[model samples]
Target: MAANNITSTHPAFFLLMGIPGLEHLHLWMSIPFCLAYTLALLGNCTLLFIIQADAALHEPMYLFLAMLATIDLVLSSSTLPKMLALFWFKDQEINFYACLVQMFFLHSFSIMESAVLLAMAFDRYVAICKPLHYTTVLTGSLITKIGMAAVARAVTLMTPLPFLLRRFHYCRGPAIAHCYCEHMAVVRLACGDTRFNNIYGIAVAMFIVVLDLLFVILSYIFILREVLQLTSQEARYKAFGTCVSHIGAILAFYTPVVISSVMHRVARRAAPHVHVLFANFYMLFPPMVNPIIYGVKTKQIRERVLGLILRKDV
Candidate 1:
């Protein structure tokens, strides 16, 4: 039998430790997490409603924003509710299969989010660098294709993770020191060799992050070059203005991910709660802030949001 009295080769369930070393503070932590989840729901739903109802927002940029909003909603929903459940009520037991499902959604949606951000960068690049070709380059049909491709790519890459995990025997124990079924954390609880799971997870993460970051950077460089070539200061300013929201979205989404990943790898001796907090931040911050960034920086979205609030057209 395992140290925790778990004897089966594969436990039927696992217990989630909301945040190791922070059990006493779980109630306090739930407050912020609850607020973040509520805000994400309100913001993303409103954003989706506005984009869908307004014919003027049928353009590629707004369409991509809608896609991003959808992803944020799903991505946040997959983790936050369960986390809040664990924190608020101490309901931490999750069925083994359910854990795998949650892991799939979490990882798959994250990949899709990265891909959509890359697509949004391309949209901005074409809109600025090749203004005349924007319409021809990113047609409605093409946008649909891009969205589908992103989903397919994420599914293809993440589909094997649960299967691989299922093949292992979890003799270490049933307790996972994470709020959600994070790949590495779960892998660590298995008795079998975890080198492949470790390497595969890291490789997939790097493949998506590095490639998407490279493309985003390259797109921005060309955008800067094109903006600089403009003779009018106002023209350059206006061109740059359109990208502010996307830039904010990128930073909000990627910064937590990179920080959490680095800390996981290098800060092994750091406080356990610190690592858990960063992981939670990666899931919570982006979804909660993405709509605010867009609503504040994108004039169309801002105006529509204000209009909805004031019950009058701006």
Candidate 2:
């Protein structure tokens, strides 16, 4: 069995590659990375500031948006600094334990973000389908509980990942062939029976993603049905309009992810660069685009952001 090849100790450092065949492009690559990070930070921070400062934005929808911004900040911050270091300074040597820490935060935040999206879907459902219970159902106490539950669920599910990794014997020298310390990327280097690690990773990922996707789809189905039954065209349009930002958020959040996962799992013959490209997009695209999409598509956020620029209270 592959488990028999396990060693007790791992190398002190793992060298991360910016891009294997494209090391020459690392500097160039940092441009987009920097742009994504900057936009993600600036946009998410502005959204957070506007949401928190304006009392009128304190409803369930905005509260979920605030949570989303916080998650984006945490998610992007978890990896971008190290990635920039890798690209700009050729600082490829990541401490082994520190890599585990990075993995924990990255995966936990990802799962947490999915949970938040699911909650947002529920918020939209309540607002559109059961307007009478919208405010009463998503009370402060309920939202707090949802927030706590989301955090707890992510932490609980992801906590075991590092420990599972710790037991593996990584005899495959210090180099990780990608820009960051992703779970499958790191574990693939270990020269042991990685079956358990691979299976558990897939199981955990599918567990979260499937449930999140199912609930999100179900909520929207109910929402669409309700919108159709509304008598007036304007009322239907208004109901659907409220969900545009959420729909954008869902697509922004899931598109790259689904692509990446499909490439990794289904298209095993995909080019190495293809995998890397999707991986980068998976991490960077959602965070950078979510805030901008909300700003452009959600009237309240758009107005508030413009108001801030014009030095007028909204």
Candidate 3:
């Protein structure tokens, strides 16, 4: 029943094209990609290490930053290595199941990142708007529960993707036009009708991105109202200052996603390599920028990092 390594349902492997229509530039393109990946790894690791080492950073905001760093590490690692392999060594083949596993980690961690951002927004809102009750509301136990709930939601929602993809019959060749095994890219190779997968994928993406973004915006609105009502201008500035890092993180994470999603729907107008580049950008950009945003903007993280550097120099 298995002919040429393809079973009745799927092929034995999928060939990942590093970037469609830009094969000639793969080697050149890998330089920036590798640099970004390296930065993402080092930056996120430093964030985690500093947060863990500093007892002063055990509060909810910094804990959420720690979570963000952890998720960025996993999320970028999921695809960047394989992408580098493809670009540098021409190792483009991914086993069918391995592709699915990569897809799961990539998407799940991405959703977790979004949820963590929303949690951070809530944290900022409470700190500014309900300062008296901040401790009572976001205790250590509640933060742990929130983290668990984020993981649970992502897992429960994404667990079905692999199963659903398994049902499709892939008659199209095993060549995928993009670097990673994105849900839509893989679904396109299936000869069978993909209406369900398309609908499901869009629905899930909208549910996560839109719903989380709406709440994040709402949280900020309340925060803004509370800040504006403060009689002291200095108090208002201090409150707004606290949210700068979170705002940067949110923009860094969501902007690429939003642009890439929009481009996907209007694919015919844009070139193939453009879409692939944007996909890679969204996957790599947030992780690379997040630590920089926090390190530069958050006073505590910056001071801790400087302290470590000075100690090492001594």
**Which lDDT tens digits does candidate 2 get at residues 1-314?**
55454455677888998677888999999999999999999999999999999999999999999999999999999999999998899999999999999899989999999999999999999999899988899999999999999999999988998888887778877788888889988997898789988898899889998999999999999999999999999999988999999999999988888888878779898677679878888889889999999999998899999989988642
Q: Mark the 10 consecutive residues where model 3 has the least summed lDDT.
A: 1-10
- How far is each candidate from the true structure, as Cα RMSD in Å? 2.9, 2.4, 2.1
TM-score of each: 0.96, 0.96, 0.97
Candidate 1 clashing pairs?
none
Q: How many backbone clashes does candidate 3 have?
A: 0
User: Could you arrange the candidates by lDDT from highest to lowest?
Assistant: 3, 1, 2
- Per-residue CA lDDT of model 1 for 1-314, tens digit only, reads 36434332578899999899989999998998999999999999999999999999999999999999999999999998899899888999999999999999999999999999999999999999999999999999999999999999999999999999887889788999999999888999998578999999999999999999999999999999999999999999999999999999999989998898899779989998899899899999989999999999999999999889999643
- Each model's lDDT: 0.93, 0.90, 0.94
How do the residues 200-247 of candidate 3 rate in per-residue lDDT, one tens digit apiece?
Answer: 999999999999999999999999999999999999999999999999
Off by over 4 Å in 3: 1-8
Off by more than 4 A, model 1? 1-8, 312-314
Off by over 4 Å in 2: 1-6, 312-314
* Candidate 3 residue pairs in clash (backbone atoms < 3 Å): none
Best by TM-score: 3
